[model samples]
Structures are given as C-alpha cells and as structure tokens.
Target: MSPRVLIVGLNYSPEHTGIAPYTAGMAQALRESGWDVEVITGLPHYPQWRIHDGYPRTGDPHEVIDGVPVLRVPHPVPHDAGQLRRLGMEIVFGLRAATAPWGRPDAVVVVTPALFASAIVRVRAALTRTPVIAWVHDIYTAGLSETGAAGGPVTHMMRAVEGTFLRSCSGAVVIHDRFADYLRGHMGVAAERITTVRNWTHISEAPTVDTDALRRRFGWGPEDVVVLHTGNMGAKQDLTNVAAAAQVAERTGAPLRFVLVGGGHQRPQLEQLATTTPRFEVLPSVDNDTYAGLLRAADVLLVNERPGLTEMCVPSKLTSYFTADRPVLAAVEAAGPSAAELAAADAGIRVRPGDPEALVEGAMQLHDEWITTGGATHRGGRRYVREVLSRGAAVRSFVSAVAKLLPVTTEHRAPATVNS
Candidate 1:
C-alpha cells in the first residue's frame, strides 16, 4: 500500500483564490506522485465569507475534489469577520478536525492561517506519533500587529502560542525566505527544519481573447488607464488607499480608473467609498477565465497594503500578475516581502503605502512607460515566472521536502517528477 498523507487546512479546491489553490494544488500533485492523500478542511467560504451554494450548512461532510478525499468540517461563516470572530472560527474547526475520523496517516501536513487549529492538530499528531509538517502561509501574530488588528498583550500571547505550534512541527514549508527567517529567529524553529518554496501561478493557460472586446465588456474606454487590483479586499489590503488614489486621479483628471475585484470584510467599506469616488469602481469576483482576461486587458496591476504591514503575508496576486505580462504597481512598505518580490522579478514599480498622490503618480508612470516602450518593459515579469516561479519546480520541491520529514521506510514511494 502507498504511504498516506493527510492535509489539514481551512481552505481547499474550488475556492480558486488565496490559500486554497496552493493547498489544492499540493494535494493534487502529491496524489499524482503516487502518495495516498486525504484532506481535512472547512466548508468553502473565503474571499466571499459565506458557504458556497450547493454546500449545505448541515449535510454530508465528505466529498472528493480533484480525486482527493476531503472531509469538510462545519465552522462559523461570519459575514463580517473581526479578529476575535476569525479566531473563534479557527478554534471550532481545529477542535472538530482534531476529533475527526481521519485515520492515522504516515505523515500530516498542517496549513497555517488556521494556526490555532494547526496547533490542535499538532497535539493530536503527538498523541498518534505522527510527524507533522507545517505549511506557513501567514504569520498570525505579525498580521495582528502589522495590520493594527491587535497588539500589546494580545500580540505577545499570539506570538508565544504560534511559536510553540511551529517549533513543535517536524518541519515547515514557507513561501518566502523572510517567512523562514521569522520561523527560525523569532519562532525558535530550527533552521534545518524550514524550507522555502515560493508559490507559483495556479492560473491555467489563459485563452486568447480580443483585448478591445474584453475592455469594452468591462466598460473600459480606450483612453482610460485601468489599474486593477484582484483578490481579497481585507484590512491588510488597505484598499481604501486604492480608492483614495482614484479620488486623486478624479480630482486631477488623470484618466486613471482604479478597479478592485474581489470580496472580503472591507468590500462594503470600499463600495461605500466608491459611491462618491468617480474614478473608482468595485466589481464582484470573476471566474478564472474572466480573471485571466481582465488581468491581460488591464494597463497595470496593483498590490496595496496598509502601511507598516511589513511581514505578515505576501499577496498571492503577484504570481498571476506576473503571468499576465503587465507591469505591477505596489503600494507597500519598501522593506516588506511584497516589495522584495517585485524587485526580484524586476516586474513593476512600488510606491509608499497609503500615499494616494504617489500611487496615482506611479500608475501614470507605468502607463507612460507602457506607451513609450510598447510593453517591452513588462517582459521581465513573464521571464521571472518562467525561470523562477515554475509550478512544476515548486510542487516537486514541496514533495521532496515533505518526503524528508516522513519516516525512513520502504512502504513510501519516491517522489515523482511533477508535470507542468
């Protein structure tokens, strides 16, 4: 029998955005590589924080996605999720996952962001003598302090708890080197136990579409410069800065349109701001194909974060933006992982976070550069994705890393070459 691995997380396939794609992709890759994989996750409720249609609130908890067995646990679907409420939800899910009927697997991979729940999984793993690998997506304590969601005693307590959880894991896989540093230096995770595997673009080959027709479908004028921001519009995103930049463009007649596409707790606030902000628009999330076409059609892509949010998370949208062959404009801290990624890819431009004037100026600069250079300046992003962010390479690296954490035994199959 093939060695079995269990993946525990809050999100999975069919969500298409944020952490789901990565988790789902990893599970699929592992199964293709000859490992028996199972998933313990929550009901689909992400970017849009309501359970997806067809998934009843109370019903059969088991389903198969992409050929992997997934056991979904019911958790609170908060319409407006505050930090406390989010934590409460995680706790409930973690408790349920800990007691779930998932049989003992040779190894377990716990996805963080569901940090507290992962901690509970660690306790269960300890009891079962099952080695656990932590896949760190975001540092919860850093998020709380960096986004001004919480601080002081609360931040300190969370840091202690999170550190204990990660340190106890058999190993960890992080998307950025900076995350590895945090795990080793701050969280006391041994350096040898952490692996950095950058996330790759999960978007499939985008079908060629007529650019003019695509633009017209979205009501974008030929003369208008569209700066598009996709994915979660959460507190960390600080999309208000994007809205403010739109207002600045409107007042200055800059001909720039800032369009935010996604859902989150902050969407309502951004929509409210868009009511009076003529240059700003808010659109609901689009399907993957439409998302790809929108990315291809836009003049510039954007990554906006609240000021002082240096190291909590790296916006996953960068991967897709790079693949779209468009220059990116990031309003983020100069020292943060997002800015570092932009620099590494030689992709786009970055301005100080929360500065509307600077944001608009940067967007105009990109537009001018695109016109002058005829899109040649943005080739670096595509090259970076091809050379550095290959999906095959990332998945293979993760599988190899997980293989090392498993017990030495002939029952386990060797990791297979990942197909692109």
Candidate 2:
C-alpha cells in the first residue's frame, strides 16, 4: 500500500496556462514517486474563461487525466466576472468540493487562488485528521490592494481570512522567496513551515519550427520585429500599456509590431483598442505547440504588469519566456518578483511600468541588441532554465517537501474507497 495524497484546486490539466500546469505536474510527479495521487479540481476554464471544447458544461464529474484520477467540480464560467461575482463562484465551488465524496487520504494539498475554497477544504481536512499543505500561488489580500481591485476594509478583512487559512495549514509551499517572506512576516506563518519551489517550464521540448514560415503564417514580414506577449490579458497584466507602447512605436515609425496572444476579461477592451492601433494586434489563445512556436519565433518576449502591482503574484510566463531562448523585456516594478527573477536569470531587460515611451525604447534597444549580437545576448535565459529551472529538480523538490508533511506511521491497507 502506498501513501495517498489528494490535491484540491480550481485549475488542473488541459488548461495549459497559469496554475493548471503546475498543479497537474505536481500530481503526476507524486504518482511517479510512488504516492497514490488524486485531484479534485474545476473543469478546464482559464485564460479563456469559458469551458474548453469537448468538455460537457454539465455531466459526469469524474475523469482520469494523465493517469491521475480527477473529480471535476462544475463551477460558473464567467465571461468577464467582477470581483464579487468571482468570489461567488469560488464559494459555490468550495461548497460543492467540501460536500464531494473524496475518500480519506493521508494528506491534502490545496492550491490557493480559489482561496475561499481552500479554506473550506482545510475545514474538511481538519475533521478527517489529515494534515494539509497550502500551495500559495498568489496572495489574495495583497492582490486586492495591489491591483486596485479592492482596499481599505475589504482588504483588511481578506488579510485576516487569508492569514488564518495559511497559518492553519501544516505547511505551505510558495513559488518565490519573496512569497515566503510575505507569509512569515505579514501572514504570521512560521518560517520553518514554508518551502520555496520555483516554477519550471512545463513545455517539455524546445519548439522546432521554420522561423520564416511561422512568421509568414502570422503575416509578419521580414522587416517586422515582433514583440510578443502571451498569457492572460487581465487587469494585473495591464496590456493596455503594451497597446500604448505599440501606438508610440507606430508614431515613431519603428519596425516593432506588438502582439498579444491570450484571452482574459480584458480581451474585449483590448480588441477595441487594437482596432485603432495599427502596430498592436490581439490574437486568441493558441495550442501548446503553437504557443511554444510563437515564443521561439518572436524577436522578443514580454511580461507587462500594471504599475504598483509589486507584491501579489509572480508572472508565470517568465518560465516559458526563458525556455523560449529569446530576448525578453518586462514592463514591471523594479522591486517586484518578476523583475527580480528576470535579473537573477540574466534573462531580460526591464523598464518602468506604465511608461509607454520607456517600453518602446526598451523594445527597440532589445531588437538592436539581438540583431547586432546575432541573438547571443539572450542565451543566458536558456542556460538559466537548464541550470536552475529544470522540471525534474522542481518536481523532486516539491515531492520531498510534501513528504515531510505526511504522517510517519500508517496502517497497511487497500486503496481507500470513494464515497457514493
């Protein structure tokens, strides 16, 4: 009999971006490391807020993905949900998950984004005497304040709630050291209870594509220097700044063409903005292979964020950008996790956030540098990926961290049965 672990979160496999890949990767890695792993997650609805094609809107809730048993809880798939509406969806999912028939497991790992849902899962874990590990993807309270989503009394209340949920966990895993510090210093979680595991590129292979043909497919010309930004186009992403930079570039007659590839709540507004901005283009999300190819084909990769969004989340796209082996440019706070990560990797250049003129300058600088150096300047990014962000190392670290949280003794028993 093997130790069993259950992972509860709002996102999982088939949603290729954001937290889904990491959660899916962790589940698969745990199974390979000899743990019997199962996941309780919502249906695939991410970057694109609607459910993915081929999945029933309402039907059977159980499926096996990549050999791991998953219970998919149906939840609201809002097209452009406001904060309150989103919270309502989280509550509904949490209630459903808490009442679901998951067999008793030795331990549980809850991913926080669906923070309220995680708290509900924690309460259930308490009843079963199962230790819980919190996988912190973002600090919800900080996000509310940082992104200007909410503040004052609302943020204060959320801080109290988030702190309570994290402190109650047996241990917590954070993706960045900054997050660990935030947990210990602000949230009052003990330092010893937190582990830092950086995210790794989930794309297993470097994309192999004909650069010319790929550019041609997108209608990009030889003279055009495409600066691509992929992933969510949300308030935090502040892609409006990217659009502004494109307008600036067009005015200055720069060869740069800014392309945003992803869907989110802000996509419609960005599309409307794009109609009048010749140098800026918005494309729908692409499959993993196409995404990887786009990363490789572009002259530069971008990470853009709203100004003052310093402490809420680390841009997950940075891992993929490094793997893409292209010159990178970030429009983010100088002190934020994304800037720190890029500087540490020696991967890219960063400009002040919300400054369209500075962004255009940075893009042109990177383009010239890439042309002059023949793309040698950005090799450090690929080297960094191999040396520091290898998937095997990341998965092993997560497995080891999780092992410490499990009970030392267990009865030899058959697999636990699911409740009917």
Which prediction has the highest TM-score against the true structure?
Answer: 2
TM per candidate: 0.96, 0.97
Q: Where does the lowest 10-residue lDDT sum fall in candidate 2? A: 411-420
**Total backbone collisions, model 1:** 0
Clashes of each: 0, 0
Give the lowest summed-lDDT range of ten residues in model 1: 411-420
lDDT of 1: 0.88
Model 2 gets an lDDT of 0.88
How well is each residue in 199-296 modelled by candidate 2, as lDDT tens digits? 88977446766666889999999899899999998899989999999989989999889999988999999999999998899999888888888998
The C-alpha RMSD in Å for every predicted model, in order, reads 3.2, 1.4
Over 4 Å off, model 2: 415-420
Q: Candidate 1, residues 332-401: lDDT per residue as tens digits?
A: 9999999999999989999999999999999999999989988778568878888889888898889888
Displacement of residue 121 (Cα, Å) in model 1 is 1.2
Query: How much lDDT does each candidate structure score?
Result: 0.88, 0.88
Clashing pairs in 2: none
